[model samples]
Every structure is written in structure tokens, then in C-alpha cells.
Target chain A: MSVKYIPVQWNNNKWKYNAVMLASVFAYLWIFIFVTPDLMSNEGRINGAVHNARAFGSCAFLMLSVILCIGPLARLDNRFLPLLYNRRHFGVMTAFVAITHASYIINWYFAFSPSNKYEALLFSNTSYGQLSGFPFEVFGIFALFCLVILAATSHDFWLKFLTPRIWKRIHYLIYAAYISVVAHVGLGILQDQQNHTFTVIFILAAIVVATLHVMAALHEKKHGDPLAAESGDWVKVCETTDMQEGYAKIAQLTAKERVAIFLHEGKLSAISNACAHQNGPLGEGKIIRCLVTCPWHGFQYDVTNGSSPAPFTEKVPTYNLKVEGNTILVDRHANEPGTYVEPVPLNIQGAAA
Target chain B: MDQAQAIFFAFQIWCSIGALIALFFLTIGIDRIDEDAQGAYVFRLLLIPAILLIWPLVLWRWFILETERDAWPNRHRPPRHAHFWVAIALAVFIPVIILVSLSVRQTWPVDFEPQKLSLLEERKS
Candidate 1:
């Protein structure tokens, strides 16, 4: 199994990708530069701030879009991974532009116009400036700070310096950054009447991302150990003989709130109903080649050890099971690692009539 | 040239400076022909533009501007370091030029006018 790094890496295409991106951004920059009025007057400065902020927000969204697309794009075709591999650079660049956009706004409103009556009164003493004055700006600033950390630590040198687990945990801050950006867009840009179109678009983006997260959560609730949250470890509720030949019997045990121990091909397999990737119920997904494949991301877990076949794949804990003759009994408490156990053979006892 | 035209010319010169810097970095960073085989050609292609672009900026920084002490603080040998100073100067100068250029350009080349609902409306006499 190839151990592909999360966020991946690129070799030569990195240079090309950066070049194309920088060129496009500069080209747009030039186009805008030659058109917009100077920040000389009060109105011009405000407009400039708004323009820069919107551009930064849009750039951030593009970065998010690219990040979201990388996984699906890689799965669709391996060749696309090169683009996906260098996504960190894109993310960092996007954040830098965003920060620049945000800083200009701060400077325009607060620092630049300190002499003006409105500026001094609005920004100088009040918490409103800190809180609502730049509604999205604060979140945008936080997100950019996180992005800077993420980008700086993205190199192999940093990866070695910070262990993979610590790096992974730190990287999770991206989701936090996304949330902040969403908040920024919602509160900052949407409040103004001038940015109606962008406000609608940002809201729609928020809805979509939120919907994905909700769906993932619901999936976990349905299939994940009904018991693990309620109890400590996942419990085996039933045994092989009690279930049908092909299908596993669903039961709630002491630890695992709900479990399905399938007896297939004269083998006993215990699994939590939920999928790990998106919390899709394992019971709903088909068991193929002794592996339970998630309906969502198609993450496959080996029934024997409850670990994924691929590296960077995680596993769920499975409980101990026992067969007591015609009646199947399971020990929900004890568990042993790497002990290859088989499901008991079944005789159709009830459906004969 | 009059003040406006001179300014425009200066702007154009600045624009060229910005474009040159962008092109330089872009050429080095990007794979134009091929990254592996024609590595020497890439470097050679960069030389002419680098020299032409750097020479004037160097002169401006040293003789005309007299800001070399302030600008090139890291440089111990003032006159001799003109070439290196020019490259660094362009690098700093280019981004600001590009950003300012974005603000000055009032009209986007692409039509941003709200589109008509139907083709018939758009084609109306």
C-alpha cells in the first residue's frame, strides 16, 4: 500500500502551477489597477477597501474550492494528484492575498483616517470597531494567521520537525479557518447593501459546506457504534448462529449500543454499523471480499483486525465474540489484537415454516 | 512630454518594469519549453531581459535617486553593487506597481454589464 501524504507533494509541476497562478493573479491585478479610481477621497478609500476585501474573500473561496476538489479529483484520476499535491502553495498564496486585502481595509478605515472626525469617533474608543466595525475582518485575520502557520510548516523540514500526528492536529485548524471565513463573509460583506450578489453567493457556499458536514454527522449517528458514545468500547451484541447465513443480526450490547456480527463464508465478522469516513452505516454498505466498504468515501476496513488496508486509513475497535453451540453468545468486554477468529456455521432454525 | 503624458510614459515605464519582473520570476518558476531538457536555454533566455531591465533601475537607484544609502543598507560596496541592487529594487518595486496598476485601471476589458434576460432582448433594435 502506497503511503500517500495528506495534502500530498509535487515535484516539477509545482513550479508550473505556481507560475500559472501568479500570472493569472497579476494579470487580474493589472486589469483592476488600470481601471479603479485612486484612494484619495474618503469615498474612494472606502470603495477601495471594499473592492480589496471582496477580492480577498473571493480568492479565499477559490482556495477552498481547490482544497475541496483535490480529494475527488485524485480519486477520479491519479494524474490529477500533481495539481492536488501542490494545493498547500495555492492555499498559502490565497491567504496572503486575503491578508493584504484585509490589511488595506484596516489601514484605510482606522490607521489612515485618524484625523477625520468620523474615523476618530467610530474607530478610536468604541468596541464596535473591534467587534462589528470590521465584522469579517477579524475572522479573516485569524484565518490568514492560521494559513501562514500552515504554509510555513508545510515543508518537509517542518514535517520532520513537527511529528505527523501533531502536524495533522494543527492542520485541522483549516476547518476552523473555513468556519471563520464563512462567518466573515456572512457578517462583514452581507451586512452592506452594496454587495448583494456576492453576499448571496457566499451564503450559498456556506450552506453547501454546512450541508456536507451535517450529512457526515447524520451518517455517523446511524451506523457508528450506537454504544461507544453511551459506553466505553464497542460491544458485540450477538453471535453468528443467531443471524441468517448471509446477513448479520443487529443487536445492542453493554458497550457497543448497536452492532452487526455477520457470518459469511463460514467466518464471523464484527463491525460497528457506522462508516469511518462519513459515518455511513456499515450495515447499509455491502461486505465485499471480507472487507466492509463505506458507502460514502468507499473506505474499506478488514473485519478481522478492523483496520483499513491502506496507510493513512484509521480503524474502529471490535469486541470479543464466542459461539455457545446452537445459541450464539458474545463477550462484549474482552478484546484481543490480531487474533483471527471465524464466525460459526448457521442452520436455518426459524424460517423453515 | 507634458506632465500627464510624461506621467503616462512614466507609468508605462513602470508598467514595463512590473511586466519585466513578473516575466522574469514567471519564466524561472514555470516550465515554458521543458524543465528537464532545456535548462540552459531557460537561463540564457532570462539574461537579456535581466540586463536591459536592471541597467536603468541601477542608474536611477544610484545616480538619479541618491537613495542608495537608504535603499541598499545591506550593501557595503555602494557603486559596485548596482547590479544586485537593481534586481532587488525591481523585486520590491514590481508588486507595488502591479497593485497600483490594478486600482488605476477603471474599466475591465471583459464586459461586466448585467446580461439581458433573453437573446431577443440583447438583439433588440
Candidate 2:
């Protein structure tokens, strides 16, 4: 929330989110250990620890699949926002499970190798040039490394230190990790196994992720704000009646990005539509007193001047805006961040609370 | 240390030095700056271990996509969809790798790996 770094302010929701995740993970392992082997005993003799390893691998992969799906699902509908809120928690849990998966396999299979398990995991298979027995373990290892980086840095402390753009770029490794995972499962297991169910699940998960992202992009394109009307030197955003008190109307400035036109306390103020934190769309947010609260995270900046309140310093670019007849005219040249302009009071008698 | 051990450590040294050089460019900023670099602080310090492990790919991000170069006509700029292509490649490439590995199972022996050989024996029988 501030320029200076702060630890995650873990609240009740975070605690509950952690507890539920812990329970679900244990339950999954429990079923994998005690129940799944029994169900599949007809296939062949099951090595208990190796079976457990495969179980953990599949579980982690499935959990990651769901985690990947949850993002686009939440974006497509707010009903899934609750799931999105604790996504880092989900990722960290997946990392833990994946570690168990890798550890078990290394201990079971690679331990007996002439060289150490860790070394053998990479070097034992010199089949870099061949396909059938190409060491698929490295794919899981790659995915694990990606997951480890993501899980370790999922804390808000890293977010503050790395900054949102870098944080997001690094976190985009999750999709790469997912791809590695899909490959890990396909090449490692599906190639050898007579059973095709998991292959179907894997393909479906890929399709679902790809489809959702495409659909969400299309949806944003369809439902996004209308183009602003252009005047001589100013862009006409909207009428005063188009805005409700404590809410914002958005407009794209010529040669620049979006702007948020806020009406609060019977006064109008305009600022850059992007929140300084994570570039969240400020126009979708509502004002509480002088501050416009970003919807993505609760980052706030003063609508009157595009500055955060005292102690927590952050600023967003501002625009000069005036009313021409009833239509709002916003200057094409946006003011530098934290620049102030007096809010022009509306003449309307009644304002929504 | 054996030959493989020496090779691995040698690889690590080369990668770390390369990663450090890339980190300098990333820290100082370059002409081909990625748009997302705007919010980023100095994170090369945290990325040391990652750089040590996968320096080649990490260096690519800096040298190409992370860096903002003048997009020359018919020349490749830093791809906006670097991660997307990697993801797509993973979905297809791994299966192909496995098929290739399967095809040449008999062509080469996994040297210095008797345990793997025994496992291979079981499959063969």
C-alpha cells in the first residue's frame, strides 16, 4: 500500500484460505494413498512409494490446472473473485505438493543409481538426442523450479520490492510452468500408460485455458468503454448526468491512455484511469470521500489531485477538465503525476450518496 | 570430481558470469525496454539464483523481449507473447521428445547408470 515495503497484512480471510487449502491437500493425499491404489490394483502390482509419488504428481498437476483455470474464470465473472484473492496460496500449496512428488521419485528411482539421485536426475539420461527414453524428469524439474520461484516470491513483500510490473512478468512464469507440467504428464506417463483418461483431462485443461483467455479478450473488446468525442483541443468525455456521485466515467485521451472522470461531493475531478499500483483500471473504482479506491486491490489516490493521502505516498497523472454546456471537455495534455486541480462543483441540487 | 561433475560446475560458472552481465544490463536499462519494465524496481539481486539455474533463457528476456529496441522493418522485436509461445511449445514438444526417446531406446546405453539399465532390462523382457 505504501512506497516503503511492508509485510503482508494477513487477515482472517487469509488465515481461513490457508486452513482450507491445508485440509484439501491432506485430504487429497489421503485418498491418493489409501483409496486410489485399491481402485487401480487390477492394473498390476503397485509399488507403494512410487504409487504415492505418481499420486502426488497427478495431484499437484491437477491442482495447478485448477489454479490456472481460476484466473480466467474470475475475470469472466466476479463470482470467482473470491478464488482469485487467495491464488498465491493455491500456488504455494501446489509447489509443496510438487516437491513431494519429485522427492518421492528421486528417493525411489534415482537413489539406486550409481551417482547421487540429484545428479542422476539430470545426467543419468544422456538421451538428450533420443526421444523414447528422453529424461522427462527434467521437465518436471523445470516446472518445479518455476513453481519454486513463484511460490517463494508470492508474498506482497516481493510484490513491493519487485514492483507490480516486474512481479507480474515473473509470475507469468506460471503459464510456462503449466506448459512444462502438461508436457511432464504427457511424455512421462501418457506415453507409457494404456489408460487414456488423464491424457483427455490434460488436453481439455489446455483447451479450457486457451479458450478462456481468448474469450475474455473478446469480452473485454466487446464491453469496453465507448470512444470519446473529440473537440478542438479537448476530448469530450460525457455529460454530468452520465456520472453518479462517488463514481467515475472513463475516456481515452488522444495519443495517451485512459482517464477516469470522477464526480464526488457534487464536484468533478479527472485523473489517469490507471492506478499506480499494478496499473489497475481506476475508472471501475468508486470514491470514498476524496480517495478513489482501485477495484483490483484497494490502492487509493485522491481524486482531486491524483495523490495518495499522507504517510503512504503514491501519485497518478491528472488531467485538466471543464464543462462546455453539458458535455465535459478534458485537456489532451495530461498533467504530471500528483499535479492538483480544483474540483469544479456541479450545479445539480441532489447528489447520490 | 569426475568428468561430468567438472562439466556441470564449469557450465554453472559460465552461466553465472553470463547472468551477472545480463543483470547489469537489466539494472542499468537498455534501448529495448519491455513496456512492463515501468513498474519494476531493481530485482536482479533477487533473481541471482534463478539466473544461475537458467541463465540462457533469462538472458534472452533481457537481450530481446525485456529490452526495448527500435522495431526495425522486417526485423524481430522483443515479442510481447514470449511466455505464450513457450507455453504452446511445451504442450507439443514434450510428446515429440518422448516419441523420439522411445524410438531410439536401443541405440544408446545410459552410461554409468546400472540401476536404470536394470529397469530397462525389466521393460525389455
DockQ of each: 0.01, 0.09
Off by over 4 Å in 1: A1-53, A59-136, A146-179, A204-225, A228-262, A271-286, A293-301, A306-318, A323-329, A334-337, A348-353, B1-125
In candidate 2, clashing pairs total 13
* Residue-by-residue lDDT tens digits, candidate 2, A234-353: 888888778788889887663236778999888899988877666566888778878988776677899988888987666887889998677788986778778899998775653344
Q: Each candidate: fraction of true contacts kept?
A: 0.00, 0.05
User: What tens digits encode model 1's per-residue C-alpha lDDT throughout A192-268?
Assistant: 43424444555555444444444434444454333322233433354333455445555555322345576666666
Quote model 1's TM-score. 0.43
